[model samples]
Target chain A: DQQVKQNSPSLSVQEGRISILNCDYTNSMFDYFLWYKKYPAEGPTFLISISSIKDKNEDGRFTVFLNKSAKHLSLHIVPSQPGDSAVYFCAARAGNNDMRFGAGTRLTVKP
Target chain B: DTAVSQTPKYLVTQMGNDKSIKCEQNLGHDTMYWYKQDSKKFLKIMFSYNNKELIINETVPNRFSPKSPDKAHLNLHINSLELGDSAVYFCASSQGFGEVNYGYTFGSGTRLTVV
Candidate 1:
């Protein structure tokens, strides 16, 4: 069973527009959620994170929103640039040191 | 300098051969992990070591063994390689075990192909 899921396999947006990526989880024990951006052939880099206690967390052009009641979360990027195009993975932390990752959503930002 | 480094970026080996992947972390973290990314692009944890001791071992085959000679180094050795073993293996490290507050730093990855 997949504890975390990204329903959308891909997303596309125009330059300077807002891009939203959504994720859902089935495990209620997950208190911490993180977003990682990965380039081709490179390891994932941490983007932003949100704790279950907070509904939203923002950093620069990236913002992460969590809806604990809905068991869902979303990552928002404003004024999306071409450099923002990459695979976005949503991870949830629960039982142990390991974090469960979603299948990943490929985002494409057009010029 | 790279925080986490895994040698042999790409390996192509024949079936039934034994191979080992070496991983080292210079982040001064006490916890290290081995994660495998399957064909479906799902990253799953295979094993974890803390302070040179085994902590988490996922439901993997016995042929796959992890050895931690020290807190900074964790190596994975596989015996009798199979076609299903072809995947990208990643080495990661963190300050503490089961602590999400400190995110993990992952190596580039070692791609293994079993022919």
Candidate 2:
């Protein structure tokens, strides 16, 4: 059983547009959510995160929104650049340190 | 300098062979974890250690053993490797045990192929 899931496998957006990626989770214990961006051969780097307490968190051009009631979350990147194209993963953390990661979504930003 | 480093970026070995992948973290963290990403790109946790003590051990096979010689190093040893063992393994570290406040930092990853 997958605790976290990314329904969309891929997404494409033009330059200077907004790129949105969605994720869902089945576990109610998850209180912390994080988004990580990964390049082809490199490890995943943290992008943004949101706690269950807040509905949204933004950093620079990246924003993460969480809907605890719906058990869903989304990541939005405004003015998407070519460098923003990569695999994005959504991870959820419960009380324990163990984190559950979604399958990942490949985002393509056209120049 | 890399905060988390895992040796043997790529390993290709025959079935039934024994292999080991070493991981080291210099982030002065108290917890370390090992995660495996299969062909489908599904990442799952295999094990987690805090202060050289085993904290979480997923339902991984007995052939896969994780050893933590110290708090900063966690190594994975696989015995009687099978063809299905081909995947990418990642090592990560965090500041504290069971703390969601501090996010994890992952290594580049070691790709293991069992032929």
Candidate with top TM-score is 2
- Over the stretch B8-111, how does candidate 2's per-residue lDDT look in tens digits? 99999999999999999998998999999999898899999999999999999999999999999999999999999999999999988545655789999999
Question: Residue B29 CA error for candidate 1 (Å)?
Answer: 1.0
Error of 2 at B110 (Å): 0.5
lDDT of 1 by residue, B43-103 (tens): 8989999899898998999999999999999999999999999999999898885566557
lDDT of model 2 at position B105: 92
The per-residue C-alpha lDDT of model 2 at residue A4 equals 96
RMSD of 1: 1.1
Model 2 alpha-carbon miss at residue B75, Å: 0.3
Error of 1 at B81 (Å): 0.6
**Model 2 lDDT tens row, A1-105:** 899999999999999999999999999998899999999878888888888899999999999999988999999999899999999999998666889999999
| Top candidate when judged by lDDT against the true structure | 2
